[model samples]
Target: MSDIQLPEDDEEQQLYERETENTPETPLIRRSQSHESIISTLSAPPAYELYPPATTWSGRLLNFFRRIPTRFTQSSIALPTLSDDRADERSISSRFRIPQLELHPRIARWRYPIVGLCVLCITIFSFLLFCSIFFSPASLPSPSVPDKIANDTAKFLTLNIFMRPPGVKNNWSDYKDDRTDFIIRHVLPNYDVVSFQESFGFGSRRKDHLIRAAREMGYNHHVESGRKYPWQIAVDGGLLVLSRFPIKDSRLIEYPRGRHSDWMARKGAIYAQIECKPNSLVHLYTTHAQASYQQITSLWDDDVRTRMNQFSWLHSLIAETSGKDGSAVVLNGDLNVDAAVHKEKSSPTEPSEESSEEYEFMKAVLSGEGKKINGKVEYEDSWKIDLKDAVYESYGFHPVTFGDVKVDEYGMVVPAETVLTDADELMAVQSIDHVLWSPRQSNMNIEGVRVEKFMVADTHLDNDEDEEKGYTQVSDHYGISYVLRL
Candidate 1:
């Protein structure tokens, strides 16, 4: 291979030699030479040219904005200055075209992983959203009506007014007004036979207020639960059976005993034989059994056990009172058993058996078979009723929530003056409140009597303290109604 070489020019070689040779020159001579170089460059004509004035008035107006200098950090682009001769190659006034960027190898290596992670996140979110829509426990639809009867209907209503615990309702006679209003507006006009739990008053005022409301509302006949002296007690144990018809031979029976907190009240049963028509007579038994009070750690807790006893007692009372009278018999009240479904987490202190955990009293009521304390009630659930009104149907029933309340066109909150929907309406399960009728398959003539319509009032107001929060109802539990074709 030959070594490559280039010919050297004489003038360039001579200048390099002169610069390499060190000269002891004075400061004044160096200064004069620097000044002369600056003068020569400044005197030269400019190579680049500014763009011509914009032709359109709008474009010319932009010249005012161009005077403002942009800081380096703010400027996103840099442009190259072209020489005067190169200006003919391209127009400076034309728009700057975007160029493709050459990404660094390090950044390009991470691009695929980032895209994969984003897709994975989106997929997971979509799957969760899909599951929420289809599988959420809330918003479960109520069960369809078992058998809508084609017979004539006799309306019956039963409600737990939450009228007791007068101390709780001491605020401006809160529940008192609600009870009166509901009876007059909703009950009197609609229901034929009405039964109320906790209808008695506190202190010396037993039936004065409720009696007035009933009479004023046109419920002329009121039967006290079978007691020798109906008006003797202090709290009235607050159970009363009011009839639009003649209440014949009606009485009240107190449970043998109550458990835990229920001992405070003389809780018991109310039974009435009503003449629905000249020939049509129906026996109605109403009772508020000892409540389980709250969460039961053990199925064998005193509350559950006592409630069982009360159930048996109630069944016995109904059997003795009605006794194959051939007349239709109906039972109504808050049994406090989660009938359809209950899977409460058992307390560790009390190991829970599946049988013991859920109320066994419910088993007896549904199947109409249990301990022979009252010799078993042969009653069936009203075609497995469902449609809210069931406690434990929801995590907790809070009536006063700031839900999507109706609003005016001006965006003001339009408050409701009355109860719109009752408790448990959202849950399509019958956890507790019910209407038990003797199935009339045996009575061919009684085929005309059928349970027509069952509805639960949304009695729980959104705000318990604030009157404006929810529906104006006193009871935490909803009132139950039925259209019984007599």
Candidate 2:
């Protein structure tokens, strides 16, 4: 061993042994101890096969094409061995295996419940649609026309029809075609002239339907206010006048100022000269003034200020056009000005009070009291002429035309607010809708032309059976109608 002179390290020793000993050089590739050939390395799984296949076929195919270079490089390492029995099967399975989704246990458990919920929603929607189409309310039978009245007598009505646009939510109800149709068929035929405020939703299906129905019912002549400005987004003023009589001339005068959302629509009055009979012309004016909300308690609210401005403008219009040529002036509208609001006492220190300054001012302005526009034209609230005494004696004052009342499920008239109990309490709320007229001459006003028929229309729901308990009006305000004997 010492003479062998081993090299400094194992490298020199291996070199000496290989050179000195008679041996054959090993081949570049050799078999492993387990007899597995080096070529088996090429049969290993491709790069993409390490992860599970994508759920979608398109995704799987995309992965296949995207990893082609990686597969090619891996396969190029060595050729497949002919000795391997499952080589082709392994290759085909790895490249084209179908995906298997692996959903969590919790998600799979709730799948049926989610599907059932979707089905339930779809069923409810279909049922609502079916009810809306088939079970709709039909129009009531038309009432017979009244017998021909004296040539000098004329009938007029004012109503806030509540034909607001769709999608708006209110305290009473949504817009109903049956109510509108009922008014057109039954209410309008009984009167010579009708003025409607809040007859909004111009060009909508509801408005168009009402117009068509009115025309069919012999209300051929009509007039409405125009837009306040050309570039406005809101519809035209919500005032509409439908008359069986012939209209000689008509015009709309929009107020220069509006408050709150009232500015969106052109709020104004419709002035029409309607011939009630042969050579008997009546100057008719219909308007919808600024609206004050339920929360308002002060007389100096913005809505009040806006209404005062409109009132002044209205006075000017009547003074300029009405009471001329001996034509009778009739003013009809939802004034939104209550005659009085009775506030109940809260404690011993507090006392009940009634506020009515707005109502007083409105009367003064219309009657030419200190206002320059009222020099020639003077007006009087028609309800106060003759019916006031009877109304006062029975109910203490004129009943409210506007109140928080609605029909319950059982079709009973009930107060919407919890503070009130009986529907009669509504009479104490306040009176806003009215009919005011000035005499053909102040001398002949009270003597000749009285409110012959001072009646309230639509005081009960159309199909209500209990008149005493179910005295619900279709609109938010009651319809006021009267007969004028000239």
Candidate 3:
């Protein structure tokens, strides 16, 4: 190697001298001067230069080795001459080194750990979901009917009978025949016991009709009771329980007579206790409660209060009797009282004049709203039977409505007419009509105790005539019947 001399007064020397010199000038002037110098230097060719291709093995090796640190020093080695561009290339190469590992194997091995972790997470999530579905209470099964009881009991028959007897002027002679024919034909052949309501006793003719019907049906045990009118002729609107079994004891429970003159025409309940088996007795209660009356009248309030007291008394009496005898009781009747209607909630705001008048009438009869009848004796109205539970046990015992009467459409029953005029009366009628055993006959499991089919027996009643006339033909309500298996 030899020491080389360069030309004097070259562009590079000029640029260096210009950059070193400083002048007291404005910032804009300095920046412009600096920019001009930079452009001139960038355009000028290199003062000393050498060229070498980067593709050579030795060159690449040298470039590769320059990037790594070493413990030994090689200070005696001569430095290679390189152009500014070549030095830039070498500097870039020195910054990064190619890894010695295989590219495919590295990628394959890298994916394994990620894939494994993902699979493990998925499996854990699936296991948790499965456990939640199977072990939760929502997945539990509902109770089914017990197989043991189903296999033992035979299917019992049920029958419903309704009669709208023709008036005495129409056919007085055939009344007994028609009554006897119904028992022998429709009732006795189908059911084990027949329960009757609205059994009119206008004279010996009506009594003879029931007696002959019971005789024809081979029902040796029968009962009938009623109030005697001023004419001394018995107005036979009483309940009768006819059965093949012997009659034990029977009594008519006279409900509180409403002070209203119209209420006197309505009848109270008939309670009976019949011996179905040697050591077992089944109790029967049948009645027709108060009728629907107009509002702003004393009759409407009196009827509601009277009916409420009647139910309270009946419940107390039954509770006492059933408690004492430990007997399975069947309390069925044509209770004209509407449970759904009584339980409705009304707003205090004044309605339209027409609706307000009707509502007032309904409120008078309802007296105390939400006052439930079939409830625990201790808690008053606090404990009432859930309607859904009661209907589930008995299939046929359902709410029936005439005309536009609806029950529980919006969780409350509403009748077409609260007041009963001759034309609107028939359309206004609505009732539960029939309520089966509270706990249901099929659900009873006590030994030597069973309740057979219980239903309303007014399927045959013709409801075509005008309200008053039609109501008088048969009782305004249906009758309840039940058979007990002891």
Backbone clashes, each candidate: 17, 0, 2
Best by TM-score: 2
Error of 2 at 437 (Å): 1.3
Compute the lDDT of residue 73 as modeled in candidate 2: 40
Model 2 TM = 0.55
Tens digit per residue, CA lDDT, model 1, 397-486? 212211112346996544322243322232222335555666332231222222212122443323333344233433445566666665
The better candidate by TM-score, 1 or 3, is 1
**TM-score of every candidate relative to the true structure:** 0.48, 0.55, 0.43
The model with the greatest lDDT is 2
- Which parts of model 2 are misplaced by more than 4 Å? 1-150, 171-173, 227-231, 294-299, 341-355, 370-396, 404-428, 442-472
lDDT of 2 by residue, 18-109 (tens): 67567434222212411244345435777777777799997896676557445334423344343334433334324433454444678656
Weakest 10 consecutive residues of candidate 3 by summed lDDT? 347-356
How well does candidate 2 score on lDDT at residue 78? 40
Model 2 root-mean-square deviation: 15.8
